[model samples]
Target: MFFTRKKDIVGIDIGSSSIKLIQLKSQKGTYQLQNVGLVPLPAEAIVDNTLMDSASVVEGVKTLIDSLKITAKEAACSISGNSVIIRKISLPVMPTEELEEQIHWEAEQYIPFDINDVNIDFQIIAPDDIDSSKMNVLLVASKKDIINDYLAVFTEAGLKLTVVDVDSFAVQNAFELNYNPDPDEVIALVNIGASVMNMNIVKDGISLFTRDVQLGGSLYNEEIQKHFGVNNEEAERIKISESAADSDRLKDILARANDTLAIEMRRSLDFYNSTAGEGKIGKVYLSGGGAKSAMLPETVSQKLGIPAEILNPFSKVRFDEKEFDPDYLKEIGPLVTVAMGLATRRLGDK
Candidate 1:
């Protein structure tokens, strides 16, 4: 699946809170956004990256496609969270064919799941400069049961699944397309979804490290609900409404939640620095639904001591101002990065 090519495929991101889909048409080397749609899922439709309500997800995807009027049946979707494992390991340098044959054996030592229960794939990265005999490889494995659940949802929704990608890599693709970071700069792309935050560290447009943290927008909602003694729906409404009567209280609650989020992010950054060596992350790009949380960017910047800002996935994509509201797109841009990245794929992309 990693090596196959896909074409005319829409990127469908089945998030815990919403189902987002984006279709892009490549013009020259740049992409033009042809269609975009988002449909919120019923609570608990997808919990912890597991499909708890397949019918709800299927219906959500169908609604998004119908609302967007998207005709493309082929789609690229992504998965993340505890069910997926991505590891960068060093192994003896060898031919591509040999590596392909031996990757399963190498993966056994790193992946905690039984070998037969997981689908494994690997990409050979550049060899180590200091050790001529060793090479770096990126190994991706996901539980077959989880993969099957996604496949079933797509199938039931009447969309052909072209690619199953990890959330971190998908976000990285979107960031590279829009920002085109410098080769020497190490950038951290953090996607804060409903229940997960995927952090991908990239240098020169190549992903060097990736990690998923179990914290996101839901925490803010929980905090707000607890603080205000309101239901989740009411809490979310107050959190998003700037003119709500309890706005000040909501702000304080959100700030505290953001503080906890920042602490977790800082821990992840420290872990990355400790493992990846001395280079500092030049910039931090925040994405996903959690990016909209109040004071999140400032909190992250202050804690990590690195410039942090919300990532606009549409920054480089071509789209008509008349067809879409520029302000609305900008506001939700972070949440669409993974879908936009998935949309960049063609029928035969390597």
Candidate 2:
């Protein structure tokens, strides 16, 4: 929303647990993966979407770029959590040139923070009803401090950050690129990161309801650590069944965590239903690292009474079989969905 993007830009996801980068080349409208990499960060670097250790993030980005040999200096990154806000609002029909000034004034009522503290962007979603008085707009705002922090890190890491987008929209972009949802179908895109889960409900390819739930994979690791008396790294290994423990007790712990995850997702779905008055979600697409949990899809499906599937962000993307293994891509599909979406962003797309 701030800068004009170049023709070639890398998509980078700076998350609580790691930094991910994906660069793609487009030819005749089809995206071909050029480079992809992930670098794990110390848990102290970020917590609950807050940057706790700036140096670690800076080094992580540098390392990811170096390891992947990504030459693209201009990149797109995303932000989420409580510091960011998204709302679909209606305003009296007005000229395009006037909407920007009007939005800053009208946004005061909807935004909780001081108006000057945030950087805002809006998109006209419903331009129909020229005869009517109002038009629908999707408003997005991010705390200026947070945005500055991101810009600083990317700069420090030797890259130019061109686009700063919200996490849910990036996931939505990825979903549309990979799959075409039915026009009448309501679908939920749930992206579970280390510390937050982004839930965006969409219909006809437009976001109708979005929420960031503060429950994610890190909580599962914490539970495993507390229950098994292990540190975080070991707990992650045990959580994924890499390091052995009492199998029965491990199942019990994971079962409880899965239940909690489904419950949090259910609460969001219920809220979306009540406020939006939308019909039930016909299907759900789960992405991000937390989607790797074995029982997650079943748990979410059973709780939400909706069919759930792991989203394949590469369904339509092309890549060399040797450079990217099919089995590996299948396994990491959920993990890279957001970055894949960000990678598809163009020079001046809405």
Candidate 3:
């Protein structure tokens, strides 16, 4: 007997502090959430976007997949941090075939790593309306070692890897699907994880600029631990709760940390504006663990002078209300943006 299988691909977002899995089914053109799961990893399981303990990561991924009952055998995963590089460079207008042949040569000028050590890919973005001689191209180069690490982890978990994407692009995919921003709206999608923050600038549903900062939610936890004299777990709980012993003192520490993060965010935005010359970012969308902080949105908005809000990746996707808690989902909504984006992919998506 022969059986036909579904084409859905599970989206697995392996972060420094947690692993998030999301599976979605597409009927006609609309998507519905099929399954979702989150599993926390031991401290330092992943640091600075490097999978230090593949066995532990495999175990975490396996447990989450089993718990979610996700049957999809193909998975789409993403990576970020210092090992991956994304650049938009102007190239002389040429045919797709010609561009493909010359991309490796062109990439060598922009990518910092040894040409042989990275996997290079390019996409031809729409050219400047006025510049006919030069067309814009999005160049992506990722370290082969990092790619192999992800492949090994997913393989050990017994899943076929369908596509490997960048974290910023995945988040952009999810945002475009749910938000459907206006063609001219310049928006920044910032996903703050445990040890890194991915800032992607999108205008008219296309990524124009992206940068990874080494600052993330771990800073707050560490600061809280130092200030309150508590262990990591207790520090995490106290960091998000309002009933700490010295509430006023705790607030001061959090404010300082938040301000420091905001300053870094501002630097990124400033760099984007100065370099892209497209336009100022009209708004900012926050995702990942750090977005849950009590004062982040307010602090970022006040400091950056840009309106900031948490992005709900499920706004346009359907799900049975009875199967998931709406309030709880909203609370953790930002954390799943990248996974939801990855889940939107198919086996051959480019």
The lDDT values for all models are 0.86, 0.87, 0.87
Alpha-carbon RMSD to native, per candidate = 1.4, 1.7, 3.3
Question: What's the CA error at residue 137 for candidate 1, in Å?
Answer: 0.4
Candidate 2 per-residue lDDT over residues 1-350, each given as its tens digit? 54443487899999888888889998788899898878899977987677889999999999988888777888898989998988988888888679977889988898999999999888888754554678888889888998899999999999988888888999999999889888889999999998999999999988899999888888789988888899999998887763454887788888888889989999999888887755778999999999998699999999999899999988999999989988988877788888888888766777
Candidate 3 regions exceeding 4 Å error are 1-6
Q: Is candidate 1 or candidate 2 better by lDDT?
A: 2
On residues 1-350, what C-alpha lDDT tens digit does candidate 3 reach at each position?
A: 00024378889999998899888989778898888888889998998889988899999999988888777788888989998888888999999899989999999989998999988878888886678899988889999888888888899899988788889999999998888777888999999988999999999878888999999999989998888888999988887674598989888988898898888999999988887777889999999898888789999999999899999988988989999878877977888889999999876455
Worst 10 residues of 3 by lDDT: 1-10
Cα lDDT over the full model 3: 0.87
Comparing 2 with 3 on TM-score, the higher-scoring candidate is 2
RMSD of 3: 3.3
Q: List the residue pairs that clash in candidate 1.
A: 5-347, 5-348, 6-346, 6-347, 7-346, 7-347
Off by over 4 Å in 2: 127-131
Clashing pairs in model 3, backbone N/Cα/C closer than 3 A: none
lDDT of 1: 0.86
lDDT of 1 by residue, 1-350 (tens): 44244467899999999989889998888998899878888899988899999999999988988888888889898999998899988999999899889889989999999999999888887788679999988899999998888888899999878788889988888988888676899998999999999998888766788889888999988987787788988877877773356777767888888999888888988888888853779899999999898789999999999999999899989999999889988877887888998888765553
Note the clash tally of each candidate.
6, 0, 0
